[model samples]
Target: MDERLSVAPVVPRFAAAIREVAAVTAFYAGGSIGSGDYRPGISDLDLVAVIAAPLTRARRDRLRSLHRTLGVAKLHCAYVSLPDISDVSRKHVNWAHERMFRRPLSGISRAELHQFGVTVYGPSPAELVPQIGREELATAARAELRGYWTGAVRRARVWRTDLHVDLGLTTVSRAGVTIETGRLITKREAIDRLPALGVPDDLTDEIRRRRAGEPVELTEPQIRARAVVARALMREQLTRLLG
Candidate 1:
């Protein structure tokens, strides 16, 4: 483990705890952890564990208990079976936000696995997961903007929350760059580019400060006003890219 990586201690502790319940063969760390832009409390520890076999009911129960005991919020992992590694759309057991659920292994995740995945305790991601091309990444970006974000803009209430305002806008920045250049940028970079996307400087500054683990407070009306601007910006960007 490199000392420079912010989540270095988390990798081994999580890997050991996960192996206690499942036969995790190839353990990998991706997203901010792999991209070298991890902010200790702000970023999520996105991980992947390739199991030797499909998890049994008993094993899933044990894994669920383990996550509860670990109590590390934002530490999420997709437990993928070896046989299911190649299929990006295949639904697999996942642990996120301290809850066990099932979701398809997304194309963006696979792309990150291939591009900057860190092999923590097994063979390289390239040996287990197939390489994801740039075009596929671009397509996935467009689909997300067209799909989830389209609905998010329609919902006025969700934008008022800090998590939604920050993540939603940053995602648009990231998706737009990926759509145009087929490249991934860290959240830090995305924040810097928010102004280029027509986001107000003060709002971007607040986002940056909050991401740095500083305290930020906003009144109800202020939050709602920012939310309105964010939604319109998202809608305009969606039209620019998708149209």
Candidate 2:
């Protein structure tokens, strides 16, 4: 632990909380914490755990309480059943504080889990997650670029926030890189490579400034323009591949 892990100070408490969950067999950390790129007050702790089965309402509520007690600002702990760890076809439901959603672990997530994700409890993530092929990852990345992100930008009605500027930059840059190379890069790496990703310097600076907790505002027009530009960049990379 580099001590930057938001949960590091509370690992014992986190450990205590997980142990209380009788269903949790294995827990692996992900996101920035997994990559050791944690930015104080910015990067949240991401955890993926294998459970005996789908967490019951009582168990879910109990786990949520632990997060409050732990006092970690952003903790994303998702649960996959023991049988579902290797079931790539199965969509797993994970609980992030209050939200419960279905999203199968992506190849990028697997790469990080296996390469650097720390085990909070139970077995190693490598033992639980199967190896993912780069081709498969590339395919998925392309699909996301064409579908989710293309829609994501257009649907956004808000800007000038940390999530709108800083988070958006990371996702766009990461998606662009992954679509082209099928490799997962850290958030910092994504920022550093934004120029090569065809991101305009103004937008890049927007992310940097927002990340530093500066107060910045972008008009609705500016936000929409940034979204269009990002989508265009992605489409360009996507086009070159086919050409």
Candidate 3:
């Protein structure tokens, strides 16, 4: 890949909504889409900015422009207020993000995000993460790998098999999790490692259920239930990559 083509910082054209968000915000981290390693057909200009307040019109506009200029890699971005940094829900969001985006633009980094993880809703900035221990991380990796494999299986039903393949590839590649076979490992090989991390059989069942298009199903009102399943699966996959 030519360095010129790599996500060089371009002045983003944004709407007033996006500009408002960018101007007032104290960005923790963000940069060119797909600031990390490059993979064919799998890159996006992603941004993660932490602000002190809700985004305004200009902010939203700029975000869109940033993506458009960044090209087909699809621009992914997140905006969170400083207070939102410590919120539980926000923490979960950040936790999930860590798996998918460990490396950021050259100027942006994940260290700050991880710092937020250890001090959710707390004042201390120096507190060490006793919970995100080695064992915990290892467990997370296994679960996440399972998530990637299972997600691949289920998404294959709704989307094309190639998309599922791309999902697994993108997730793993983004997470920077090393696999001896790179991206070509078989499905069984992928699932085999997940149980060691404490992922329940129920998850596998759900993946299978969705893939099989089972008769027993939840209605639209039960969307929350559906999300729960997806979230769990995401956790497993994200954890594997980011953990």
Candidate 4:
């Protein structure tokens, strides 16, 4: 917490890759990774890597190093291009990244850099990231509630592990706060705020256990029930702010 950048052993390699490869113009540690909630056992090394141009061969290899060296389970950094950040409609490439990533580049991630990001090896997150409005952030959060989480438990069986439940619940809770406040909150803050934010107590407890390293198991019905409540809470919060 004392250090501005708290990260895993793999971070040195990430910075090294940025320095070694010319294609990466900048990189910033983001989300909880930047918010001083970094837990080596539970947290991920969230990042935003800005590309100098296209995903060139050298740049492509550098991106690949993230997954290969850091491992998919522990890292989820997005590789963004300037055009998408500048033009609002250019559409950041996700297909290329999906081959080696857990998720794709996001506009909110770009926006978060300006608000909550920690600079690791960048020109400062504020200077490098283009401004993305609150509506855009609200729009993205709403879609994830209606589209992504709604189907995630159904398609992938979300409650099979505590990790999924924790992430799903934590994401929606903090997302609500972010949508309303135009700022991201730490996991601790999100958990504390969940009750007033309309998150179910059982789901909130599970999230706590997930963070405490306590063993947790949920039935399919339990997960489905919780996911329904979470999705609804996010929907209400996002609508109130966005509308």
Candidate 5:
């Protein structure tokens, strides 16, 4: 590995955590530490591991423990199986997989995994896998933000300062439909564009109020109602754009 590739200091520690997972038969792809292939504002560690199946209770517990330890600021980890790559479906996964070789520390080479096409690490693949489209996935992601925003609104009303801000950014990113250079519009700019996407006037108002340091709280019922609408709109846009 190149000295530059060893940039992510948490690689060794993360690999150790994977080992504690019990059934993980093999591990690879540890070097893409700071790669922009995932989401923005994700300053956490993202890793992929191949595991051996029949996960024991102890193994699950170990994963939870690892989560508690790594949850500290500046460190986060997400584990996925090899076959799950196919489920991501987006062309970006191919691009991301290819870029793995450029990272500072890689247990798995970009070429090796792709050449094999689909590699199975454990007895079987993980139960849940991320399935999405390049176009549709973006829309679906935005819907999540919309739901979070509603929650942010309620949290603000209740003076839940921490959650309000957290969900505020999340909501804007989801409901904002403008895609600039292949990204959702910036949170600052999304406000202006929400109306065009048919977002309700009140939701936008709440977002603005929160930005201005107002207390807003969106109840669970309110969030669910908005999420239903947001999901429908996102699917509509994605269908048109993706087609």
Candidate 6:
């Protein structure tokens, strides 16, 4: 692991919390933290924990309480049983945005685990998670756009928010790259590619500066205009890639 790819201070603490609640066989960190693109107070901490067995109702309650007590915002993790590691289709216990639910371990996340996962405890990601092929990666990226973004693009109200604009545009750019090349690029890289994807230069600059911890504000009219532009670009990219 590069010296720069250090886990956030909260990771070890979270891992310790996991041990207190359940038996974690292996724990790993992926996403921005694993890719060396983490921006303190900006990027999310994506994590995975391979546990000894499936979560029981009691354990789920405990885990939920643990996440609430920790109070670390933007920290999301999927808890998978050792047996479920080989199957991406199986739903597992997940915590995101302070909510606990069941969702499958996504293909992109599995690929990240194999590529650059940082071991907070237990074996490396490749040692446990299966290697995902390029075609599989491309297929997964397409499903995300076709499934989620399709619904998201239909909701005009969400596009007006900064979160939607930043995430929507970057997601399309990143998904397009994945579909074409079968490689995952960091969010920062996706942001840099926004202008080339026909996103307005000013909006691109706002996203870049905002991600860098700079304060950015847009007037209501400006936000509405950007929302229209972003939705159009996302719809165009989705058609181009999914077709």
Best by lDDT: 6
Q: Each candidate's lDDT (Cα)?
A: 0.87, 0.67, 0.37, 0.65, 0.42, 0.87
- The per-residue C-alpha lDDT of model 3 at residue 168 equals 49
lDDT of 4 by residue, 1-243 (tens): 226563564664665565545466777777776677777767766767776775666666765765565454656556667655566445443323335433445666666677778776758877867777878877766666665666664544444456555676677777777677767678888787777767777778867877867778767787677656655665565455445
lDDT of 6 by residue, 13-127 (tens): 7887897577898888899887888998899989999998999999999999889988999999999899888998999999999899999998999998887688888888878
Residue-level lDDT tens digits of model 5 in 95-200: 1311211111121222222322122233222232332333553545544444343344333243233334334433444333422233433344555565666667
- Which portions of model 3 show Cα errors greater than 4 Å? 1-6, 11-19, 28-36, 39-42, 56-73, 91-152, 155-160, 169-243
State residue 150's C-alpha deviation in candidate 2, in Å.
1.6
TM-score of each model, paired residue for residue: 0.94, 0.78, 0.39, 0.75, 0.41, 0.95
RMSD of each: 1.5, 3.5, 13.0, 4.1, 11.7, 1.5
| Candidate 6 deviant stretches above 4 angstroms | 1-7
In candidate 5, residue 136 scores what lDDT? 52
Q: Rate residue 170 of model 1 by lDDT.
A: 93
Question: Regarding TM-score, does 4 or 6 come out ahead?
Answer: 6
Candidate 2 off by > 4 Å: 1-8, 64-72, 156-162, 217-243
lDDT of residue 15 for candidate 2? 55
Tens-place lDDT digits, model 3, residues 47-149: 4555556545665455455545445344444555555444322331111222322221211123223332121122332232122333433444355566446
lDDT of 2 by residue, 37-128 (tens): 76666667677777888777797777666656666656666677777777665777665645656777766677778766877767787777
Q: Decide which is better by lDDT, 1 or 5.
A: 1
Q: Top model by TM-score, which number?
A: 6
Clash pairs (backbone) in predicted model 6: none
